[model samples]
Structure formats: C-alpha cells, structure tokens
Target: MSEQAPHPATGLSALLASTPFARAYTHTALAAVFAAFAVERIAGSVALATILGGLAVLGVGILVARRAEYSLVRLAPTTLLMFLAWTLTTVAWTGDRGRTLAGWVALAGIALIAVVVALVRDTLQIVRALGDVLRWLLSISLGIEILSGVLLDIPIPFLGIQGRIAELGPIQGIFGTRNMLGFATVIALITFLIEYRTLSVRTGVALFSVILGGVTAVLTDSPTVFVVAVAVALVTAALVVVRNAPPERRRVLQWVLGAIVVVAGVTGYALRSTLIGVIGAGTDLSLRTDLWSTLVPLVRFRPVYGWGWFGPWAPAEFPFNYVNAVLRESHASALNAYLDVLVQAGWVGLLLFLAFAGVALLRSWLDASQRRSVVYAWTPLILVALLVDSLFESFTLSGFGWFLLVLCAVRAGQSRSWRERMRSLDGPPGGVETLPAAGGVQGPDISRG
Candidate 1:
C-alpha cells in the first residue's frame, strides 16, 4: 500500500480556508494582541507595529478575496468615509508627520479588512466571531492575572509590574495603567451583563474578568476611573432597562429615568473631589483638577483645530519640556469623551465625529423600535459606554475603539437595509415572502425561474 500523503492545507491553513468566521475571529484576536501589548518603546513605535499588522491583514484579505465569492460593495461607503477621515486628520492635524502618515495607512488598511468582513459575512456570523475573540482575550488576561499573583515572590521582571501582592487579594490584572485597567474592566463588565441574557457560561467568565478588572482599577488608586466606571455602568443599566421595558410605559419611564441619571451624574462630578476624599483617593482627584485647570486655557489657544492629534500644542515643534506641567500629565480630566475630542480635533473634527456617531445611534434606536434584532440593543449601549470613557481617557484613537465603531456602523446599515427590503416584500398588508427576483444572480436554476 502507498503511504498517505499529507494534506496540502492542514491545521491553521485549513482552518483559515474552510471557516470564514474563524478567519475573522483570528484576525480580530491578533489585532487585539497588538492593541493591548504592542509596546512601541521596546520595538519601534505603535505606528510601526500597526503598519506591519495592517500589511499582514491586507495580504490575508487579498487571498480571501481570490478564493471567496463575496461583494465588497456592501461596506463601501463606510470604508470610504473611515479612510477619508483618517487621511484628512493625518494630513491636516497630526503633528508627527511620519507617525501620522503611518497611522493613517494602518487605519485605512484595517478599515479595508472591516469592509471585507462586513461584506463577506452575515451579521450573526460577525457577532459570534467577535464574541469568540473577546472571550479568548478575557481568558488570557485572567490567566495572566492569576500567574502574576501566584509568582509575587518570584520577582519576574515584566509580570511583577502587573500587580502588587497586596492588590491581588480578590482580583488583579495587568494593564497599561490603573485607569486603563478600570476602563477595560468596565467594558468586560458591561459585556458580561449583555452576555448573561444568552450565554450563561460565558457570562460567568466575563463576570470573573470584570471583578479582576475592577480590583486592578482600585489598586491603580485612580479614583477617577473607579468613579467613572461605576457612573457609566449605572447609566448603561438604566438605558437597557428603559429600552427593554414594556412598550406601553417605556416612553415616559425612559424620559424620567434618563433625566434623573443625567442630574445625578452632573451633581456627582461637581463634587468629585469631595467624593474622592470620601473614598480615600483625594490626591488623585486633586491632581486631576489641576490638570483640568491647565488644559482649559490650552483648549482656548487653538480652539478650532486644538493642538492636533495627540497634542499639547504640537509636541514635535514645541518640544514639551515642562515634565511637571499639568498639560504633560497623563489621562487626567473630569470632562467627558466629547470634550476630549473637542480639545484634540477641535470643533470641526468633533462635530464630524459626533455626526457619524449620531447617525449610528439613531439607526440603532430605530432598529430596536422595530424589534428587528437584539444586536440593535447591545451595540448602541456598548458604543455609549465607550464614548463616555473617551472623555476621560484617550481611547477614541485606539485600535479597539475604532474597530468597534466601524463594526457597529456596518451592522446598523445592514439591519436598516434588511428592514427596508422586508417592508418592500410585504407590500401594504405586511405578510409575504414570494417576491420576484430581479435580473441578477437568481440562483443556480435561473433559467427555470
């Protein structure tokens, strides 16, 4: 008997070829790794890592296109707009020219992959893929936290920095900073809540991740993150209740509850320093106040374009020497994400970004009203939390944020189109499926039809 020859495409190769959803999951998972741990200081810069990653994605996209039967046009407008915004922002505002150009190229390339995913796959497939990716990310992060905790006595170089032995009592995780860790925890927490309605096992994992994230945030001793995360979570929970309540009472209840949440959040912010003191994190609050005071005048200096992408008034040209200056402080502010955008992109960029976001939010609400899909509820709420986080943290420009935004927009657009198509087929009475096919790919037996 002849020996059996090895299959040409085995293991990862076969997986990529056979499963589009898995391919998407792998791409996003790799992207997350780059986003979370790719340190520019150690190896080139963040921009360089993004460029290399983008190149790899572009290569895969090309290969996938050659083999798959799909239409890229489904995501054309979104892809075009995303590329345009990144390019214009880089050309017009970004101070570090090389980094800006590279960043824009990387973003455009990522947008291309988003388009491919959106066009080639259905909505549920995309969501499932993303869910899987997030699950894996949380699991890995959890394991790291556990290892770091157990090896506290070992003095491992990088792992030791993840958490102090004391901070690991109930929960602990490694993140760039206390605030970022908290912010990430909030994301996982919210995601877990959403998942709880469907996947109980995944929900348990997400809950564990959330607790770890929260503990890490507290350990960082950043009162701002802890307070902000709680506030945002409360608001999100309220929104979910309002959105999901009985239709008869939803309108009035939503308005009343929403107004209350707004008033409460505002009042709390006004007394944030006192609140921080109450929680034994007064110094962190005071420092943030000082930073805000410094940033206010700085915002007025170049109100239109503000300092331009990642600016304390164009660092490359000015050479920010005041290491002690409040402007040089890292992620310190009480103002929300919208204000953050205003300071960086100026009013013009802010308005454009808001407009894009507004459209997506409106579409999501409309879909929920029609009771079309659950994603309508989940995506918007996540977007809102992310937007709120942006004000206090510089997260909008992050790869994860951009990816989520584009993904939500694609889902919204597709859902809208699907609803319209269904309406057209239903005619006036609204109960029909046998719509005549147009002069296009009418399936394999078009001649018979």
Candidate 2:
C-alpha cells in the first residue's frame, strides 16, 4: 500500500486549534470587560454579571490547559505556600474574620489564575491575554470618563455618591472621587508607555484613553498621585533616553541622571512645605512616621507567625483610626504598604512577601537579558513604580496592583521560555562541527561550531 500524505491544511488547522493563545485571549478580553464595568459604576448588577463572565472564561482556560501535552513549571505551589502562611497568620491574630475571608478568596483566585498560566505550553499566551485586557481597560475607562463628563449636567438620583459629583468637568469620569480615577489612569498610562513600540490601532485607542484618564487625574487635586505620576513620567523618559544612547555612553548617562533625580527629589522634599504648603508637607511626613511607629510595634507583637491572613488592619475599623479623624493628631505612619503588611501579617509574612517580589523581579531581569525582549525593558520600570507606590499606598491589597504583578510574572515566564528555546538550538557545550574551508578544503570548524 502507498503511504498516505496528510492534508495540506491539517497542520495549520491543528496548530490553530491546539494553540493555548486563543484561550488566553478570551480570558484577557473578559478581564478587560470586567475591569471596564467595575470602573464605570454601570451598575452593581452589571459588575456581578462581568465577574461571572470572567469566571466562565477562567474555567475555559483551565480546561484548555488541562488538555495540552506540554506544560510550564508551575509556580502555584509556591504561591499557595505563601497564601497558607498568610491565612494562618490572619486567622491566628486578625481581629476581623469577614475581611480575612475576603482576602483568602481573592488570594485563592489569583493563585488559580497563576496555575492556569503555568500549565500551558506557551506562557506568551498569558502575557498577550493580559496585554489585551489592559488595552481594553484603558479604552473603556476613557470612554466612560468622556461620556460622564459630557452628560455631567444631567444627574441620576439613584447613583448615590457617584451621581452627586458627576458634573465636575471632563476629568472626573463616572467615579465620584478624583483620586480613585487618577490612580486608575496612572496604571493605564504606564501600560501604554511600556507597550508603545508594539501597539496596534486598538492599543492606540487605549493610549488615547490614558491621556483622557490623565486629564481626569489632574482634575482630582490629589497631590500625592499627581506627584507620583509626574515622577514616573520623568523617570521613564530618562530611561528611554538612556536606552537609546550608545552602550558605553549609556552607562555614564545613567549615573549622572540618577544623581540628578535623587538630588531633585531630596531638595523638593526639604522645601516641600514652603513650595506646596504646610498641610501637604506635614501630611506626607506625618503619615510615614506614624506608619513606621505603628508597624514596628505590631510586627514585634507577632514576629514569627504574624496576624492571621489580612487580619490586623481592617480599613473599616483600624487601630490607626486617627487617620480618619478631623483633627489628624495621631501622625501615624502606617501609610507605607510594607508597614501595612507587617502590622497585619507580621515580619514573617513581610519576609515571604519580599521573597515573592524578589523572585518576580529577578526572573524579569534574567528573562529580559536572555531573550532581548522589550517587555523585559519595561518590566523594571513598572516594578520600580510598584515599589515606590507601595511606600505610600496599599498596593498588594488593591486589585489593580495584583493584576499588574500577574501580568509581569506572565511576561517573565514567556521571556524565560524563549531563552531556553534559543539555548537548545545553539547545541551542546564544547561541541565542534567539521566543515569545508573557504577554498572548498575540508577542515574541522574551531569556532565552537
């Protein structure tokens, strides 16, 4: 019997059908939709609807990954270990059971998603999915902001807190608080900046949304966010310039620019009261000092196991309640995210958290160096921003921050995979190949062939 040839389209069709990329894309799209609806204040019902939709997409992704023959190294077990530590700490020491349970659920969901990504043959699919989600989020967020601004004059009675200040001009969006909108806008802007080189038309729209979101952020009058955004932009621009410079010159320029930034930041802090006003100066310094004091004692109280997962500092009821007081006498410095974690989870928890972040950062750097991908270039900048924001914000506790971390991890994994593939193609160490010389004479190749 004659050997049978495969159909011409069989491979192509199989490749498309078996790829994990499509499943990842679907999840990314759904996540973007959910984020958009959440930001728009569309309706609590709508928010619930999207959450359910995301869960459905997640389920599909899980199923697809399960059927794949190849798999990436799973990071979920490590994540689960950290989560268990957090849960034990929270349960043992935390004052609020309800808040701890919520944290447990959120952490569990994040771990599940990480597992889904880890079980796939191509980790790039997860990175692409996250990129898609971010792009959609930026566009939808901008559109909602613009629409709310245009319809500001007409208010709906049932919208509650969001409706009262809906008429505040082009910057407020559907969100009543300017700071919240600004925070969200900054994330979108950073995402656009990072992905600018590879952006398509859809991404361009997302970038535009970032600009509109920035306009709203400016309108909010939240000096801290404004300062952070400006600082991030300046740093990012400087890094871009350095990256474009000749290799030798780039090193020199980095040192000079870094010194300038440090000096400028310090000088600004020293004169901040005179330049910005006493309230701003006092507010900034006081929060850090208070947080330090509060956290030091709390961490000492539970140095080993720490408070139960997400237990100690419930935002609804806090030991640092003076933060919400009109007099503002308590000058507590639990303003730092590290401090918040330390207080709630203890030193042990803090160490675990640091280990997780360190692994992510190290992986990002290693992958970028090995793969020469631009995503790696942007990873450090985003990581830096996350670290800086954590100094004054509850980054880990925020949905946006966790989402960003997950995106970074996915990109890092993709880069690492590419590096491994390249190494495999390069052949075994110290191996040599026999080849013909330029004049057609046979010779053994000596250049690590």
Candidate 3:
C-alpha cells in the first residue's frame, strides 16, 4: 500500500509554518511574545529573558530557514540598524558593563523579534495578534480587579493590585502601573477601532473590544489617559481628513496641519505656567521635571558617549543609583524616552533615535495620507502615540512599547525605504519579500466601507 499523505489542510499549515517569512507560526509566536510583554511583571525579570530568548531562537531559525529569501543589501532600515548599533556600542563605555550588555541584549533582541514579525506578518495580522493578546490581558485585568476588590477584598501585592477597584481605581491591571494600563488600553482602543474600520473582526467582537478597552482605560484613571485620548482623537481626525482629501490637495493640507501644530506647540509652551497651575503641577508633573533636571547634569558628564545602554535604570548601577539618590526616589526609568536615551546613550545616540523616530513618522504619515487603504493609518497613529507618550514615560524604550515603535518603523520603511527603491530599480529580490502575493499589510478584502 502507498504511504498515506497528511491531510491537505494540515500539510498546508505545516508547510506555511516552516516556509519563507512564515506567517502562522510567526503570528502565534508574536502573540505569545506580546502577551509575555504585557504580563511580564507576573514572573519578574526572568520572564523577559525566557520570552525574548524563545523569540530570539525562533527569529534565527526563521532567518536560516528563509535564507534564500533574504538579501543582505536590502535588510532592515538603515535608521533602525544604526540606532541598534549605537546602543550596542554603548556597552564599551557604560558604568556597569555587565548591566549594559544585558540591557543591550534585551534591546537588540526585541528589535530582532520586531524586525522578524514586521517582515513576516502584515499590519492587520500584527494588529490581530496584539488585539488578541490585549483582549486576554484586559479581560484578565478586569477579572483580577474583580477578585481583588469585589470578591476577595484583598490587595494582590505580587501583581500590584491595590484592591482599589471598589473605589473605582487607578487600577494597574496586568501592567505594573496605572499609566501603563492607560497606555496599553489606548493602543488596544486604536487596534480595536482599526479592526472595526477594516472589518477585520466581527461587529460584535469589535464593539465588545472597544467597550472593554474604554472601560479598562477609564478605570486606569491615569492623567496620561486624558492626554493620550486627546492626542489620538486629534490624530485620528486629521488622518480622516487627510485620507478623504483630494490627492492634489493632500500635500497642501499636510503643510497646513504642520503649521497649525507648530503654532499650537508654541502657544502651549508659552502658557505652560498657567497650564501647570491648572493641572496641579505638584503631583506627577513635578516628579518628571525634577527627574529630568537631575538627568540633565548627568547627561552633561558624558554628552557624546553617554552612560551606556541600560533600557530601564538599574537601581544598583552607579549613575542610576546616583540620580535616584539625588532625587530620593526609586524611579525605574527617567520617565521620558528622550531623557532616558540622553542619559544612557548620549548626544549621538539621541540624534540617532530622533532620526529613527522622525524618519519612521514622516514615512508612515505620508503613507497614510497617500494610500487609500486604512491599514496605512495604523503605523502613523501608533507612532504618534509612542512619540507623545515618550514625553511622559519611557515605555517606548522597552517592552511592547519599543516593540510597536520598531514594528511600525519597519512597516513604514518597507513602503518607501532606500532599499525598496533600490530593489525596484535593480529588479532583484528585496530581503525577505520574495514571496508572491504577500504584500505589505494591505489586505485588499478590507475596505473604507
């Protein structure tokens, strides 16, 4: 008797899992990795190593498996790689060499995983994976709040739930801070909205997801939520207007928007004293300002080379401990992404980071404005969230925040990177994009309808 072949669907799935720029396998892995990022506090620092190690191994395996598909010349965006390279270089001069190396590993490892996912998965797929992970996380967050507040009536010290859900929290959720929960829910809200707008999820599911995100975000009770909501709302409105504009008028509209943003920023700065008074600046506001002020003097000592690349401040590290001691506070991060980079990697690193974010934002924003597809909007909106949130928190420097930043950068870079232009003119394979009919996140089935 002839040997029986595996069932066609099973064979197809298995084949896809191991194929070039593998999707199903990568999607599953990405979801797990993202989930790990969300609930990292559950297991402590080892969780990062464990999850990232798993991702790193999977990343290398995929690259090896898909060797024929990759082109060294047309690899990741120059800006991204340059930034990573600069971060790695910081280990040479860091105060704590061991910690720096460890930090660089997490940074580079997350970047690698993001690069892989950005290559293999489309925008919707990434959104889908993130949405699923966030839904589980948010649901769990709500459950834990219920258990800790209404049901059990005891604070969960390990998870940092303060049993304040009964008081309509400031809930930390699976994230370790209220601000973090607010940020994640904002991202979830955006993802859920995109899923709805794109018809990627069923109507009921999308609606439920939106409600869930809203409820969770509200319960977080973070002041950042207000700022984030406004920023996202404004950006969403601008994108809608830009996308709907005539192709010829779109450029003019963008310039007008830029001018308006400049004017608004200047006005805000001029009135900052009044605004500060209105907002009661003595709270979180003063802490950030004081933290940044302390970081400024430290950054000056090694302005060019920096203190080295510790993503999150190590309490035991010299300058970190020094800064914390000066403030008499146990701050985990510098509370600002730019300030964090300035203190850790110095001026050159800051320049590289600015270029990295600026280029990505410009590319993605242009893509969103020009493309008729709604998927094009995700990258820019996400970048806006990350960049804006960076002002208040260093979330974008690590964890899922960094992952999203890199992932969006990769997505944007693919549309209009130098490598893409080179590949077009040269007419050869363009690094992991050799697969047929697999385009950059533009699932044609989804519509503006």
* lDDT of every predicted structure (CA atoms): 0.52, 0.51, 0.79
**For residues 249-338, what per-residue lDDT tens digits would candidate 1 score against the true structure?**
877886787589678879988987677678776665466567556656666766777544542133333222231353555343223456
How many clashes in each structure? Answer: 3, 13, 0
The TM-score, computed over Cα atoms with residue i paired to residue i, of candidate 3 is 0.90
**Model 2, poorest ten-residue lDDT window?**
429-438
Cα displacement (angstroms), candidate 1, residue 101, comes to 2.2
**Candidate 2: lDDT over CA atoms?**
0.51
lDDT of 3 by residue, 78-187 (tens): 88889989999998877788989888888888888888777666666677777777888899989989999999999988777897888989798768789988998999
Which runs of model 2 end up more than 4 angstroms from their true locations?
A: 1-72, 76-84, 87-89, 96-99, 114-176, 202-210, 241-300, 311-335, 365-373, 413-449
lDDT at 382 for candidate 3?
89
lDDT of 2 by residue, 1-449 (tens): 99998886665445443445446434653364335425445557456445644654554444443333323332332543674556655764666667677666655555444434433423223334555565555455445554444456353323222332244532434333344455656665665554444342255565665565565565555655666676677766775676567766865776788699789979987986676574354565665666566457656656766555652245454544534353355432355667766766667677876776666665664443333234445555555566666766665443545545554554454434343354455432111123221121223422111
Query: Which residue pairs of candidate 3 clash?
Result: none
Candidate with better lDDT, 2 vs 3: 3
Worst 10 residues of 1 by lDDT: 429-438
Instruction: Show where candidate 3 strays beyond 4 Å.
Output: 1-34, 37-41, 276-282, 425-449
Q: Which lDDT value does model 3 have at 243?
A: 83
